[model samples]
Target: MNTIDEALGAVVAAGDLAGAVGLVWRGGAAQVAAVGWRDMEAGLPMHRDSLFRIASMSKPIVSAAAMTMLQERRFALEDPISRVAPEFLAMRVLRDPDGPLDDTTPADRQITFEDLLTHRAGLTQAGFHSGPIDAAHREALGPDLDSPLSPDAWISGLASLPLVGQPGASFTYGRSTDLLGLLLARMEGATLEEVLRHRVFEPLGMSDTGFSVPPDKRHRRAGLYGFDMTGKLKKIDAPPGGVALPERPGDMEFASGGAGLWSTADDYLAFARMFVDPSVKLLSPETLALMTTNRLTDPQRLGAEMFGMPTFGTGSGFGLGVSVVLDPATAQVMRGKGGVGTVGWPGAYGGWWQADPTNGSVAILLMHNMLELEQLTAGYGLGGYGAIMEFHALATA
Candidate 1:
């Protein structure tokens, strides 16, 4: 059998990756592999504790915090979110997604907690879509990370925009989670960072995970990278103009739920493990089940497929904050091999993790290369994904 170490070593030698931290915990044992460099310029080796700007991976953690509140009866899933966020009480929908911003109609109903959790609130990413609605999103929300606006300002801006669809009508994957993060913070009368620390991070013993890396820990942080036009790995000089690295911590006040977290592979493994084992006790079995179960309908599921996620074709659907496999056979068509019940989501910065309740299995692969359009099309990012799949396949081989 090929060892995980050999596979990781091969990837590093090929220059497809600068460094990585891979962890696979199955049965009664946990195996970890670290390779290449966390800081190639300084010749620093990647360590198990190396920190990463885990964009989008922040969703599951924030969702877990919301679940903790849900268990306490703070809010019901069916409760109209307008009960707290009155800004969304009277909302508008775009008559044409690509039409003039003023061409709109009233929403069918108020957005609810379930609508936010399931990404059916008709919100879409301004960064991903191209239209007047997208333009409004950029103007209202600013960027995805490290927003210069306060939470109050951010929410006010977002509320002023028109939704892409009526509430609970379809899946729009842009900013629902980010809004959820703020809503969770508002529910607690604290910042998103404070709420997550109290509810999720502290209990899980994820000491190093947080919204930003302090000055002292900056050395342990991996530099973000992306493939150049020549297909060579290079440090990202300036992460696209409007987008921000919210996890890095700066003058920004908004803790974006959609993307804003810095963590190590081990820290995330601990988070993923909770889904497989109730002993972690982050949430009750029922709440955890709600998170991992498929929460999207057929059309909603099809909406995600349009984004070009390979796994979407294989019967995958969105859960609360992660992706769930509805058909194991179809899901196996992806580079990674997970069981029918596997649930986890990947970060835009070449990070992936999965938890399979069937075998008490958890696997995480962490890297810093940003997934660009050209790179994904050329299978450059899949080089790391293929390794993760190989690790899973090796476990059963």
Candidate 2:
């Protein structure tokens, strides 16, 4: 198989990938290409603006929005979250993995705004019905991350649940940013969608991102797809909530700051561009610097315990909401772009993006279907992306 041809073709050929869209934008120009069909059943062709379930990729965007609030002094990173969401002032830790529902204590340190952005807050989507906290959230907030809940209700719900580990201890990707969105709603006197739209999306010119897809624009909404372990692709087109509407509703479900948004390549790349040029920074350079710094203060020891493997970059470590590169020697895939000062995040549903000041460019991959992308690698976990980056490097070289 032609290595480059195979990597590009495999994305289209993968039986599990019913539809695929790939975008490459660097040096101020972009080219979008698609293969197969967006909907085999409906016979829709994938387009440049095809909306995707850019899941975890949503993290960096949402995280950046929170940092913007900090820039405006809407709040400080370390400020106790309890200032706006009072329920967290008396938070507790789960003493036993499985114990009494109400058994709890006051949090040693108040959950700070930084903790929420960094996923360092010990918040869980746990106990939706068993405890008073869950009951309060359900009753007051409607068990939705996207909808409105009293700040007190949001904090109490999170505080009442067991933390994955002590706050700021490890990188357990959970609902930390979602809490930040809820906090933004309380503090900014606006909803998560509103905060994002007003502050980030409008500025970046991201027109199609929101809580849900609208009906007229459903044509643009890429069909959501998931593959089983055996690599069988199935369409996951169900709206998260029981409510069904004619248009995609950004306010339909709990505005999940952690993982609840849809976006397109063009829209997302514009936001990624800001990272490359911080002169348009939504957050102060100092705040961005503070955020980009590796919070992996313990480096190897702490990292190993949290993640199955220590996921360090070229001297890189985990930061508030993105990955920060520290040393090139520590990089696993020896031959890609990001040198030392790159930071980025990937969405779970399907997408990867990185911004490297070192490269003076941001590379974003947006696709909604899953595949064993590592097959394109030389048996490397960087997946299909590794091969693409290497090929581009050689082409430019």
Best by lDDT: 1
Q: Tell me the TM-score of each prediction against the true structure.
A: 0.93, 0.80
> Any runs in candidate 2 off by more than 4 Å, and if so which?
1-6, 96-105, 126-155, 228-230, 239-253, 278-281, 299-315, 332-337, 370-397
- The numbered model that scores best in TM-score is 1
lDDT, candidate 2, 212-290, per-residue tens: 7777887777675554444456565443332122244443534776666788878887887776675565667787787
Which residue pairs collide, candidate 1? 125-174
lDDT of 1: 0.79
Local error of candidate 2 at 238, Å? 3.0
Error of 1 at 113 (Å): 0.6
